[model samples]
Target: MSSERPKLPIEAVELYNEFIHGGMSRRAFMTRVQGLAVAGLGATAVIEALMPNYALGQQISKTDDRIKTSYETIPSPKGNGTIKGYFVRPVSADSRSEKPSKLPGILVVHENRGLNPHIEDIARRVALSNFMAFAPDGLTSQGGFPGDDYKGGLLFNKIDKAKMMEDMQAAAEWLKARPDCTGKIGVTGFCYGGSVSNNLAARMGADLAAAVPFYGGVPPDAEIPKIKAAVLVHHGELDKNAAASYPAYDKALTAAGVAHEGYIYPNAVHGFNCDATPERYNKAAADLAWGRTIDWFNKYTRA
Candidate 1:
C-alpha cells in the first residue's frame, strides 16, 4: 500500500487545526466545513479525512517483540496527586541471559489531546532508538484521555495549566531517577507537549540534557537564561501563528549563550509531524525533523 496522504485543501486543514487547538468552537468548525464542501466531498467526508487516523501514524506495533512496554504511575505532589504514563524500553539483545543496559531517557509529550495511541506509538519509537521513553497523560487527573481527541482536548482545558506543567516536571524528575535510566534525560513533544518541553527545559535547568519542541511556543524572555539544556526547535513554514515568534526566541537563546538550533520546514503547516493527521503531515519535513531530533538527543543525552 502506498503511504502517501491524500491531497487536501489547505483551508480545510487550517480550519481543523484551529478547531483542535481550541481556537475555534465545534459549531463554528462544522459551519466552516459546510462552506468548504464540494462535489462528492461533503462536510462529513472532509472532517473524516482531516481527523486523526491513529493506525495510519503508528510506525511501531504494541506487540512488537523488539520493545517492552508498561504503564507506570508516579507521584506528582506538585501537580496532580499522581500521574500515569506509558513507559517503553528496548528489549535486551540477549533476552535469555542478560538484562538490558541502562539507557538515556526521553519524555514523549503529547498534544492537547492527552496520551492517545499515536503518542504511545511515539514512545515505542523512542525505545526503538535505544532510549527509554515515558509519555505522561496530561488528562490523567480527569479520568484519562476519554479515548477521543475532541474530548481529550476538552478535558485538557479543564486541567490547571500550572498543575499540568508541574506534572510534566515531576515526570521528568521521576524518569531521570529511574534505575534503568542513565541519569540523563531529554524531552520531545508536539503542539501542547512541545510547549511543555520548552518550559521544562527552562524549569528543570541542569536536570534536562536536551529538548526538541516541534511548533511549540517559546518561553518568556526571563525564562530564556534559565534554560541549560541543548534545544532544537522545529517550525512549519505555513504555521504563521506559531512560527512568528521564532526569530525573537532564537535571538534570546543566542544572547543567553544557550546551545540551540531551529528549523522551519517549507510548505508545512501546524502539526506537520503528526502522520495521524493526514491533511497536515508533511512526510519529508517529518523525516528530516525526526532525524535531527535523534541526533540532538544522542549528542546531548547519550549515556
Candidate 2:
C-alpha cells in the first residue's frame, strides 16, 4: 500500500487561513474543510463562512395545543388539471368551532424529491408548531412521485413556476374558506422547494405574511422587492450548491427594506435537515432552524 497520510492538524488550519486570505476557490475550501474534521466544532465550523449566535437557551414547554394534518385535491389549471396537496391545521384552536374561523396559514414547497414522506412529515411538524401548513406537489402531472423518476424526469423538468404559484394560490383560497383557518398565510421550503418559496412569495403579491427559504436558489434582484412577507433564510456555510447566490439575495432584501433574518449554518452542507442522508445531517443546526421557523410564524400569526 502507498504510505500517504492525512494532513496534520495545525497544517490544515494554516492552509484554510491561507485559502481565506487568498480568496481561493470554494471547492478547494470545502474539500479542505471536510477533510480536517476540526475538534469540538464538528465539520460544520470549517465550511461555515461565519458563526451564528447559538442561543437555543430557552426551554420549550410541552403543551396540550394540538394540530391535525390531511391531504386534499383541488382543481387548478395545471398540467394534470388537478392540484393534489397536503395540509395541517389546529383541531381545537381553529376559529370554525367558534364564530370566526380565520387562522394563520402556511404553504410548504418540497425539494426536488417531490411530494415524498419527508415533505409530508414537514407538514405534520408545522402543524404541531401551530400553523396551517399546506404542501402541494408542484409536479403532479407527467408521471407522479418526486423521489423517483417517472418518464425519465421529464415531468419534474417541466415544472412551471407560474403554474405552481397558481396551484398554491388555490390552496390558499381553500384555506381562506375553511372556518377553522385564518386568512393570514406564509410560505417556506428547502432546496428546490426553497427556491420555489422565494419565487412564490414574489408572485403571490402582498398577501403573504412571511417567507422562509432553506438553501434554495435565489431569484433575480428585481424580484426581491416584490416579496411582501418578512423572510427568514437558512444557508449552509460550506454548501457547494447555493452559497454564491444567497448573499446577493440578502443584499437585495436589505436594500428593499424588507424585514428578514438569514443564517448560515457552519460546517453544514446541502440537505442538513435530511436525516436519511446521515453524511449531510446536522442535528444541532436542523433543530435550531426548526425552532426558529416555529417562533417566526408564531410571532406573525398568533391570534
Candidate 3:
C-alpha cells in the first residue's frame, strides 16, 4: 500500500491490460509474453501482479468530513432481494431544508470489480459538488466488492446480469424519490458501469436527465433511439476494443437526433479517469472529462 511500488515494463502492463479486459485470453497472453517467463512466473503470477489492493488507491479518504455518508440497504425490486449501497450527500444538503437548495441525484455505477473505494470516493466527489451520489454494489448479493479487486472480479462473474440492471433501475428510482432530491437524475459509470449507464439511459427514458459514460461500451443502435437524456462520453483512443464502437454510437445518436457529445481522449487508455490505477491514469484527460461531465450534469439536471 506504500507509494514505493513495483514497476512493470510497458509491454507487461499492456499484456496484463489486454488479458484483464478480455481483449485476450490468459493462454494467449501467456504464450505471447517474454518477460514474465524470464521472471519464472506462470499465468497465475501475471494475474496476481495486476490485482489491485484498495488501500493504495485512495484519492479521497473515507473519513473526510466534507460530506455526509450512509451505508444503506436500498430496494432492489428486480434483484433476488435488497441491495446495499454507499450513499453520500453534501453536508450542506443534509443540514439545509430550503426548497431551492434541493440537490439533483446522481447514480454512480461501479465497474466489474463492484463497489470499491475508488468508486466510493467518486461518490464523495459528486457530493462535494452538491449532488446526491448513490453508488450501488451490483454484486451486493454476492457479498459486495471484496477488499481485493481480483476477488471482486470473481464475484462479479457469477452474478445474474439481468438482475443487475434491475437493481440499478431500483437505485435510480430510490434516489429520485428521496426527500432531499429534486427528482432530476444523472448517471455516470466507468468501464462495465459505463456500458450500463449507456444502456440505462435508454432504459430509463425520460427519467434520466443526463448520462456520462467513461470508457464504456455502446448500447445497440436500436437502444439508442430510446435514450431521452443528453449524453457526454469519454474514452481512451488506445483501448481499441471499446473505442471501435465510437463511430457506430456516434452515428446512432446523431441519427436518433439525441443531444450528445463523445470524445476519445488521445494518449489515454481504458480507465484513464480512474486515478486508482496509476498505470492507466491520465491526469489531463481525467480533468477534462470530469469538467465535461460536471458541465453536462448542470445543463441537463441542475440548470
Number of the top-ranking candidate, with TM-score as the measure: 1
**Higher lDDT: candidate 2 or 3?**
3
* Evaluation by TM-score, superior candidate among 2 and 3: 3
- CA shift at 288, candidate 1, in angstroms? 0.4
Assess each prediction's global lDDT (C-alpha) against the native: 0.92, 0.66, 0.83
lDDT of 3 by residue, 1-303 (tens): 566545545566677676665566556876776445434456555555555545666666788877779999987877748888999987754365455367899999998879999899899888888798999999899988878665777788788988988998899899999977999999999988899899899999999999999988888777899999999888998778788888889889999888999999998877888777766777899999998898899889986
Of models 1 and 3, which has the larger TM-score?
A: 1
TM-scores for the candidates: 0.96, 0.71, 0.88
Clashing pairs in 2: 44-266, 44-267, 48-267, 102-181, 102-182, 103-181, 103-182, 113-146
Ranking by lDDT: 1, 3, 2
Best by lDDT: 1
Writing each residue's lDDT as its tens digit, candidate 1 over 1-303 gives: 866544668899889988998988889999989998455677888889999999999999999999989999999999988999999988876433455478899999999999999999989999899999999998999999898999999998999999989999999999999977899999999999999999999999999999999999988889989999999999999999898889999999999999999999999999999999888999999999999999999999974
TM-score of decoy 1: 0.96
Model 3 stretches with alpha carbons more than 4 Å out: 1-10, 22-50, 53-56, 93-100
What lDDT, from 0 to 1, does candidate 2 have? 0.66
> Could you tell me the lDDT of residue 70 within candidate 1?
91
Give the per-residue lDDT of model 2 (tens digit) for 64-157: 2465555788788643577888776655633345564456788888765467656666776777666777888767654455344222134555
